[model samples]
Target chain A: MMQMADRIKLKVLDPGLLTTVQDSGRWGYQAFGVSPGGVMDEYAAELTNLLVGNPPDAALLEITLKGPTLRFEEEGWVALGGADCGATLDGKPVPNWSAFYGRAGSTLILGFVREGCRAYLTCAGGFDVPLVMGSRSTYLRAKIGGFQGRPLQEGDVLEGINLVEARDEPGKIVESIRPERDSDLPLTQSSTITLPPSLIPRYGSPILLRVLLGPQEDMFEPEGVETFFNSPYRISHEADRMGYRLEGPKINHRGKADIVSDALAKGAIQVPGHGMPIVMMADHQTTGGYPKLGTVILADQYLLAQGKPGDEVLFFPCTEEEAIVAWKERRDHLSLVRAYVDRLWRKYA
Target chain B: MSVSENPSVRFLAMGEACVVVEFGNTIDPEVNERVHRLARCLQNLLSRPEATTYQGTFYRQEYRSWSEVARAGIRELVPTYRSLAVYFDPLEVKRQALEAQITQLLQEIDVPEPAGALEAEAGSQREKTFPRQGKTVIIPVCYGGEYGPDLAFVAQHTGLSEEEVVKIHTSRTYRVYMLGFLPGFPYLGGMDERIATPRLETPRTRIPAGSVGIAGTQTGFYPMESPGGWRIIGRTPIKAFDPFSDTPFLLFPGDFVQFKSIGEGEYRKIEESGGRP
Candidate 1:
């Protein structure tokens, strides 16, 4: 029998804004009544895990808005990414996105969030966590993951189940490269990490979300579809991990209801009975019964995640091939950034 | 095994990653049985490689491609009442070669018992396959009062007393339909329509975890406390999810869940006794 609790334990003296353990995502069991539970910021979570040399799907703490204070029982290397919640290490502000060494008895306080929503904290070898439906991310709605399928509270401890590491692995801990803290921060220091100049706002001054016609594209009249692409829409207050609601013109259907609870993907803009658009997010349902008007390109999801409720958004139509190409370009860009980071780790540290 | 060709089943491509195949439409025992069998066969094959399988209302396995990009092959086998159109690019796929292999390998499969085929509706099935975990847990839940804040309201909606509402809820067996909206929140099926009611018009920003509720004709349990509008009737002491447990999900799809009413004292006693859900 494995004595799991003894290895790595954390006393969560306080449960920051909203902290949950998450990985890339929960997969392969949605049909069996299991939810696709995982981290909201997949990019930051994966990057932090890779930085610490843990397997891609290893679990980490996802701090939402606020952060929790933890006391670790063992010495380990940890990294934080996404959202600049002012994380303090023994009363000192720690740099974001770099590895930090914490002593066994040291108390780590993560509290950095001014604009962005989520922050990911990854351990040296990844938090030795358990997997539910083959994922380590905590899905609170289902009450099935993290610490006991619940959020961390005062006095809750976490244990690490990683294999013992050699004192000398070829890995280098670089502490200089931090994710830009400014949601409004000017990208002056680094060129590669900065948003591409080509990604500048195109549809006038407001940020209009570009989308592709959905599978049920013919459900709406040509004019309705035209209005969908041309008109400006405001995001409604009802927004969360599931999907986002949009307030716009009441779109009329050409024929009968075009949707019958078929499958739904991230970024699918579906129109329910109320004739309003609902844009599905990262933690969206596998299927929906609403008529889909459009689907946002995968490339633009990052911007959507940063969008707060009541923000002004526009829907522009794009070709499916364009969406596919755009996704590839985004992936290629991510690779370049990772390579640059790899090189910088060796140059510094 | 000299099999000719699969009548209703074939490989399908989902975007750039998963290959999907279906059996029929409608949720009869036959379609479900075949979905389960086919998933096990493909999973046995997938295990030999590193392809990760995503079994939901469909079966999809994500592949690690060049440039570190991930793609999945989606296979949905839920038995809808009619034919399901699976859209994909046929030209991009190695359909001829893959079809040959699928046919040959399918010969090795035993159709299980009664679930032979979807009666050849020109090859169409809506049955999507979800993954099955090993452990089947029987969870104990405490109903009514503080545990379920809206229990009495649900009783009123159902035209029954709170005790009668509890009786009907705990009586019928339920199966997980899908997990969505939140982590570990199971949308279970098989609820009696007698207790069916619409969700609250206004959603609460904070619905406590383990709060079981009924909506329209569906019933489910809330695993975490969050914003929800479901007509909550009661709560359970057992936690459905724990990121720290060896197996984080307490309830798997297809596994049965029954509610057991306990007093306030029993609820705390269960919590104190370390009775995890």
Candidate 2:
């Protein structure tokens, strides 16, 4: 029913390591054994969407480690967030956590990640993938949703939907917001709109993740709990979207390690008989049999998601009240940024 | 409905976002029914609009409206064997507020007696009173030979003939406790102890979908091709999970299932006719 010309499109020249389409998540269906598959870093994904003047829940390309080579078929506003992926447009360097206007036929190439594990890319209209079970996220194991329910391959074309036509000239918004540009200089090319340095998230190794212990923390012995908190674990190479298996101290259980299978919360640290804790992630199953030691707080989960394989992870125990407060602070920070971005868009566009 | 005098419930925090309301430790039908019932009640309450005032016994003046609670972001409710995990957004609702609401709902539920105990009291009344009233799903399974490589092993372990094993397996109705492990893979209860067998010491890397397998006292069929430890005694032609269909899952918690033994020729016929037996 929609005209092809009205929608902007992007073609994958070379699909990077594990590029997939993701949105907020496929919610309200976990009880039916469905995984809440979404972007690993929700904060980054939301910021990327906001940068492009799109809704926070818009479907965006989630690039893992290596990035993709995509060619814009039409002129569109695009933004990069999360990791510093060393992206370049037509061989010209593009800064991270910034928005820029890509001309039609311009090839955007993303090199290996200079920092962080995953990166997010979004256009002004968002990807036009058919929503499966009320989500556009790609749950690779189930092969549902997103661009054909799997990782993007070479030659896969993606269309941008719900384009908001700017009232002013294209690239004029970026020109007006240019902090360092002189007032006398004429705006010929589209300038980049970068977030303030204080607003950008800093990714680092040996990430300290604060956890709210329990749901099944009593299953572990006092010594096991002590070991869990005392020792630093390295992210195993076996890590993927499903979970990150940590290798460090073998946390012993007081009795049997297995419990009658129960529902798994997001960021649950499940410890099996082997004693190694597996931090369940975006694509974790609805339920698991192993006893959980603790769950990483929602606010710190972004740092955990950005953690690379072999990265050191230190867990700190926090109370439920503290966890709630941390989440509120994160939400307040995002709201501030959203308001700032909306004001900028209103003045320039 | 007459509410239970005092049902033992524990509110365990899964994280800041979720609270696991555990009914009991064991996988009894009564406890599982309560889990499903609570899930249904919460779902019904959440679906209602914001303006409607709830006049329940558990309503407290300090708590906000039902729709405000809903707006506070009750994202998902997952019902398991003895517990229901309620996942909500901590940014919108505090952990204590969500737990208090769930505790209130738990107090309102009428805990049914054990199935055996209720059956003796009033047979006709039991049917009407039961929480799950859905029709039993009959799964046609072809036992032995090439379809089930572990059939002989199961029979040998149980000290029963292969035919006797099949007969006992199909004799009783099984309760679908929950769907987990794999998508639409029902964790079935009510298997005959005579046919009980431990899982394979070395788990097979690739078990075909529709394989009816038993591990310990539990029996279930794989919905998708996945590596499993459950000893396969038979294979079913029916698709346990059809992702393409409007109803993706074939089973849900509190549903009933019955196995019907069929010959290999019938299995082939059903498989050829798109799993409609």
Best-fitting candidate, measured by TM-score?
Answer: 2
lDDT of 1 by residue, A76-165 (tens): 557777766778777866666655556578788877475556777877555656665566666665566566777878888776554444
For model 2, the chain A TM-score is 0.91
Interface RMSD, in order shown: 6.0, 1.3
Q: On a 0 to 100 scale, what is the lDDT of residue A74 in model 2?
A: 70
Candidate 1 lDDT over residue span B22-56, tens digit each = 45434444454455454444444544342333222
Best by the lDDT measure = 2
Clashes of 2: 0
Off by over 4 Å in 2: A1-5, A162-191, B1-7, B48-68, B111-135, B156-159, B263-277
Candidate 2 lDDT: 0.81
For candidate 2, the docking band is medium
lDDT of 2 by residue, B58-155 (tens): 34342245447866688888999998998888777766667666666565445444356545544333223223343489999999887789999999
Global lDDT of model 1? 0.59
Please give, for residues A173-231, the per-residue lDDT of candidate 2 as tens digits: 53233223333111223433667789979897988999988888889999999999999
